[model samples]
Target: MKWYSLMPGILLLGLAGCQNFPALYSSAKPQITTEKIEQLSEYGAKFATEYNRAAQKTCTKYTRLYQQGDWRAGWVLALQVSATNNKHCLDNTAAIQILETLESQKKIDPELLWLTQVHLNWLKELEQQTKSVSQLKRAANRKQSRVNELVKENQDLVEKLEALKAIETSINQ
Candidate 1:
C-alpha cells in the first residue's frame, strides 16, 4: 500500500480507539448550565473592568512620583503598586487555590478563570513598570554622585590657590 493510503488507515484506527473515551465527558452532576455560564461571564467582565481601573490609578500615582524626582518614594510606591496589582491578577497561585476551594464547594463561578487571566496580564505590566522605575532611580543616583564629586574638587582647588598666594606674599616681604 502507498504511504499516504496507509497513513489514513492508521489515523482512522487511532480515532476509533478514542471513540469510547469517557474522560472527554464527565458523569458528575450539577453540570454547568447555560444560565450559570452566562452569569459567570457577566461577573468576570465586570470584575476585570473594575480591577483594571484600580490598578491604573495606582500606576498613575506612582508615575507622578517618578516624574517629580522622588526616586526613593517612587521605587517603594512602585513596589507597593505592583504588589497591589499582583493581588488582583488571575494568574496568582493563591487565586488558583481559591478556585480549588470554590470547586470543592460546588460554588465554582466560571468568571473566576477570566478574572485570573486579566489579573495575570496586569501584574506583568506592573512588574515591567517597576523595573523601569528602578533603573531611572539608579541613573539619577549616579548623576547626583558625580555632581557632588565635582563640587568637592572645586572647593579643594580654591583652597590651594589661596594658600599659594599667601606664601608668595611672605617670600616677597
Candidate 2:
C-alpha cells in the first residue's frame, strides 16, 4: 500500500537527518603550533620515564621470584615488563619524530629545539635499555626451559630405576 511505502521513505529520511553528515564531511584540519608540539614532547618524555621506571621495578621483583624457582610467574612478569618498555620506546619515538618533522617544516625556538634534542637522546638510551632487557628475558626463559627439561628427564630416569629394582626383587623372591 502507499502508506507502507511512505513509511520506509520517512524512516530513511529521519535516520539521515539524525546523522551529522556535514561534520563528517568537513575538511577542516586541526591547527598545529610550536608551543603545542613542545608541550606534547615534554609530556611524552615524562610518560616514558615513568613507564620505564615502573617496568624496571617490576623486572627487579620478577628477577628475585625467578631466582626463588617461580619461573612461570617470573617469565610472565618479564614479558609484561618487556612489552611496557617497548611501548615506552614506541611512544617516545613517535613524539620525537613528530617534533623533528615540525622542526623541519617550521622555525622552532632554540630552547625548544634543545629540549627536543635532549628528549631524543633520552629516548635513544631508553631504546637501548629496552633491547637489553628483552635479550635478558629471552635468555632467562631459555635457561628455565632447559632446567625444566632436565628435571623432567631426571624424574623419568628415577622412576625407571625404581621399576627395575622392583622386578629384580620379585625374581629373587
The models' CA-based lDDT, in order, is 0.55, 0.59
TM-score of model 2 relative to the true fold? 0.45
Tens digit per residue, CA lDDT, model 1, 57-128: 654554465457543223233223334334533233433343344445544344344544454456566556
What is candidate 1's local distance difference test score? Answer: 0.55
Q: What's model 2's lDDT at 27? A: 77
lDDT string, candidate 2, 1-173, tens digits: 88997998999999999887656464764456778667756644554455467856644554465457553322233223225334422254544454455457554544456655665566667768878999999999999999999999999999999999999999999
After superposition, the stretches of candidate 2 with alpha carbons farther than 4 Å from their true spots are 1-90, 103-107
TM-scores of the models, in the given order? 0.38, 0.45
Residue 144 error, candidate 1, Å: 1.8
61, model 1: CA deviation in Å? 32
